[model samples]
Target: MSTQQSNRVTAVYRTTTLLAYQGNPLIEALPPLNSFIEDLSALRGSLKCTPEEIHLNGVERAHSICRVIDDFFQPLSQHIQLHERISLMIRGGYVGRNPDTGDWARHIQNGYERVLSGDLKAIKFTEVNSTAQSMTLIGCSGNGKTTAMKQLLSLYPQVIYHPNMNLEQVVYLKIDCSHDGSLKEICQNFFRAMDRALETSNYEKQYSMRKRLSIETLLAAMAQVANAHALGVLIIDEIQHLSRSRSGGSEKMLNFFVTLVNTIGLPVILVGTPRARKIFEADMRSARRGSGLGALFWDPMDEGREWKALTDKLWSLQWLQKRDEVLSGEIRALWYDLSQGVLDIVVKLFVLCQLRAIATKVERITPKLMKQVYEDELRPVHPMLAALRSDDPEEIIKFSDLKLSDTDKRLLELQQRVALSTQQTPEEFAYQQLRTDEERRVYMALKDDFNSKLLAPIIRQIFDQNPSLTWIRLLPLVHEYLNNPELSKPKDNPKKPKSTGRKASVKQTEWHTLDSDDLRFIYSQTDSNSEIYPAISKSGLVLNIQSLLEEAS
Candidate 1:
């Protein structure tokens, strides 16, 4: 369940250029700091789709290509700043806690004393002042805060093995604040995360599994584990959830996070939505500690060079039969209007438009189709998008971060069902019918080319629509329908029976939703935004190259 993977690398310590970073095994084992351009190039996502792959004649393949966009990250200025800040924080924190010296051992001893005494202040026994600092990154839900963090973290090994000292140097560990924002849950997750990184059940068994352990005892244990492993940095995401913390639980968590930096010599990065700003603002001491490395507020992307660069790159991945060689200004403006510059919405909008274009046989993205997709599929976020558009402080405050909750997923499902109901084709009407032998023969022949379940409806509809046509003549039409499903759109059926139940009265069209296998659904289920594509890929949503080749053969 842990999102981060450990790269158990042998310690390859280099002489660091910076004086403060020099002579520390923890700092020296890291990949050497690079220039801005080098970092940018390294951080940019490498996943790409070719034109041949895009134009592949299969709905499933098309969906897989669309899902690929989830992995398409282009580092911007904000990412560079974050990279530098985190890079500095981790190495700087390690400067004072050299494992070669007695400093690290002493720190561990102090932490064990704290754990034994059930006192957070017991770590103050050491004369070595922590060089560690904490940072806060606040952004809108879909603006790529967690994504950037994860990508940057990928530069360093999550777990490093030092054979000389028999140390498992955990470079970093990230955990989410629980939905209820319980400090106890956070402590348990920390232990679990550390256990995962270190490949040991000792920490989890010793601390987290004990139900009767006081929060103070748990905090002491958590801090001790962090020091015992020489944890480089700690990242706590969804800090906005701390708003749900009851009876000053939020304050206690904040104070403990500060102690991790000040006492344990571990840098901390707190990532959250705009709503979390109020928590920091309430306490001056916590505010100062939280922003020791300067807090970053990530607004939704604007229509600037970064936006153009991202869209231009994304626009090039069209799998439509009629690929638009160039992105036009009209469609670009419409995209911004609909997504309001949220990175997730922006990418999903592009993806859904392509899927819709393939379904409707438009073959190219247009402003009208984009708008229609937005209206039909993305209605759940309309209010949030509207709030962003208004740019009014009061209006924005009324909405929560646009994380797709269970309710939102239900809304997407209902919306999709309604869309399917209203847009029912002739194929749908004749789907179950296979009354004649000729229809059965046609089904047997085409089932090999297409999915059996999907081909049934197309074959049935062809026979019903052209009753006089032979099975020989119907083959071309069936293939055509497979390519363009909208070719046989049904006319209004006034004679059709109407629903009498309460379900009929329910306004289903207003309920917006997405499907279970949709990338958005994968995103919702995932813990880290950075891991969305990996999760989707593992879900069998992305097209497999070997399978494609085998099918072609």
Candidate 2:
């Protein structure tokens, strides 16, 4: 038999032996979930601006807020699902196996020989069966699809060297579909990406620079390079750019993707805004092929659990002078109305409102203030937001992809204005003077000394009571209160306790001694018509300790 035929026989023999020896031959090859999560968990981004940072002037504050915006990410249910889906795709796609054709053994054997020979063109293989899958993620702009994917993919090492196989495996490759949408350009892009990843300009020089090369020739080169590197997945972002009028058409572009999966056995993930939906809808075969892992259509967040969770977390990051930490119903309602639950709008509106609050010295984010910000600062996005608010699918689609160019420009202007104005504000200058390092140290120390929840309001009250006193001068009074806790407590007439028949206020104690009935009564008082007992019972609240202990038995 020839070398290729001989290798095929060897592969079959090894496969049979492995199957007989082990119940599951591919079990050891699967990527470990624990390791993936451990690696991924570290990749999550976070931003927290302290009180001092919040107190900074406009330009500084704007810069800091922008950083927060850039760093902020709240992983939702869809994020978890997307991560798992991609992981599954990678695991299935990179298993180097196809039970239908029994090609796994041949692939492994050929790959080893190719590595040993150190000849890129020596390996000869046929595409009989492919186990590659494709996934399409369609979402509105700024829904965090790209950001989440970047973070998720960052967990995996870009280039993994399998010492035993002597192979360099690229776990994933991401490329943006150019505006031209030319197949030739895409093929060149693929080569350039590979060149960057491998630290070699061979492909770029060999394929891309050659103007005479046919699209087909470039595509063949791309397939060879992809298989040579053992590419795990190919992610094409901004797929909407593949306009039929500009490129050979969406059909041709999609055909290329199908070819990749069917022949090269490389999984693909296409990510784009809602505009790309037209491309997939144009060809049923392409749509069906792309839905191998199922299509994930991410709409704007509804006023549901995910929306509440996202807003609640973002609300907690407030650094305003008048901190409305509680997410009031009115504020939430106004927020949803203004943003229509689009995450990008929600975050931008929040940052702009904070800036407005600081600029106007209102120092709080109220319903009126939020509305004013949305009307004045976010006028550029008003049309898009209105379309979303209309709940008309066609209207939404028309406006969904609208870029926020004007609004962004306006925000920059606002930042500059705030920075300039902050310097001239006498109160800000006075506040800045009082904010010495020692004063901050004392404030932080006292914050730790007292209940963190109570300290801010107490300090605000102290400042308000003695407006003339500088922060440094006020430090002694704060220390005195801390040193003598009894002096800080409100004095009550000694005879009043004897005169009143009722017990001290329930708020006085921290609920350590409150009975279940008393807690239920308090809960009922908070919402008079609501059934507290049933809710408490559903929550597994037990009135009696001995009864609960007996139930555990």
Candidate 3:
């Protein structure tokens, strides 16, 4: 019973701590912060259990409350950081687990948003409808900003969302702002997003709207459709793209965004990285007057007393789930030593350690397992971690300025190398077996050292054979002959290995389609909308009769 009570007091400490660090900076492991956590662990370690002593207050209860007073209240009495810690935690103190839903972390963030709404329904009391509203979801990289917004979008779409009551005339659209700089490109992507939404909405009554719509007709049609269906929310994601500017282009895009809210009266929700706060502040200068777009401060966990608070919250969260889960004060001390209580590091360490424990069939999370996960899973993050570890103001800005999201950017070039390595030739396997990523990098560099004698014969042979056709196809034929064919046996022109295996006879039809400059999209290089149109639209009775009259003429 004494042991259980000790655990409860420890639980309270963590619950209190994590609540403090939620939207704060990544805390450090220096003096007071580390000492505070250590002192609490020491207090728990020193607690003595007694079955006797006719005292009114339980011994365990006294120890628990004293630990809080000594480790928290007393130490915090002289520090301003501690005061800030208490304030933020108190702000979110009411956001407990929902009785029915029981989702804790998400519910609290939801509660934070609800505070603005001034109602239990979690809709802002202000003009949630009939007004231009935007939210700056501010966070640096690895803070789960994008993932949180995606989750919010998913959750909000499923809920009973509205301004006052009218739900019939509502439409919702979500678009990533990185689509392009031009207003036309942004509008074009808007239509594309709307087109997908219409396909998903799948309302049969809107069939005519869908049928009459081409991609180009999407924006004007959506504005009309919103009036008809009542478009309520428009979510513009990745507003940091405005920082990714081209002269006055971002201003133009911002103007179009303003036009959507001001002219169309559609409620806009802008989600962006920390840099987007600059764009919003800039916009509030001239044209964007009276815009009620508030910023949601999603700061990362800060250091000092806040770190201990964050660690405690994260620990208690687990304790609530499994009282018998082996992590005591000893484990929490070890965890804070390695991870610094940055939520990403803390969360990822858990995931990796869970996998590690399960792989080794261990019953509990181990400090050794934590070390291994840190080396393997968390070491790659050391560069960014080192940057965060610095105290320079410039370093802070550099860390905050996520030029491209390191987490979201595709490692496709590496993947393509792996894919190519999977399909290696016998010559490649014999000569080159790249054992590491760096080894492979070196191998690619030395590839240009090849003699022309290796290639000259191949080119000579290709030109010797299919003079009428392109060398692109002929080179592959030559490669096939050399790799898999028999030169001595006249093996049915084994140069054409695919043809040698099987032959099919079929008539070929010449294909022709006229294309304008706008009909192309080369991904990274091109921005113009596709100008191509198919010949299958309704001229109805008028277009047919006009065609007939033209024929009569």
The number of the candidate with the highest lDDT is 1
Spell out the clash pairs found in candidate 2. none
Least accurate 10 contiguous residues by lDDT in model 1 = 503-512
lDDT of 3 by residue, 257-355 (tens): 554454444556676655666565665553354243544555455545756655554333221111223345645776755654445565555544543
lDDT (Cα, tens digit) per residue for candidate 2, span 1-553: 1010110011111122233223322323323443334544455455776889766555677687666567777766677678777776776675555422456555545444444554323345665356788889988876777877877776555665545555566768898888747777777898898878777899899989999976666776677677766677888888877767756777877777887776567788999888888888889987786577878888878898888888888887776665666887768988998898888888888988877766665556766678888889889888888888788988878876777777777677777767876776443343332323444444565764675444544555555455454555556667666566677642332432222222223332233223333553335323334655654654366477888789999
Better structure of 1 and 3 per lDDT? 1
lDDT of 1 by residue, 351-406 (tens): 77776665554556766578888888788788888999999866776664767454
Q: What does candidate 3 score on TM? A: 0.41
Q: Judge candidate 3 against the unseen true structure and give its global Cα lDDT, from 0 to 1.
A: 0.39
Task: Give the alpha-carbon lDDT of every model.
Answer: 0.74, 0.66, 0.39
Candidate 2 vs candidate 3, lDDT winner:
2
Native-referenced Cα lDDT, model 1? 0.74
Clashes of each: 5, 0, 20
Off by over 4 Å in 3: 1-130, 150-172, 179-185, 200-228, 242-248, 281-284, 287-291, 302-326, 330-342, 360-363, 391-393, 401-553
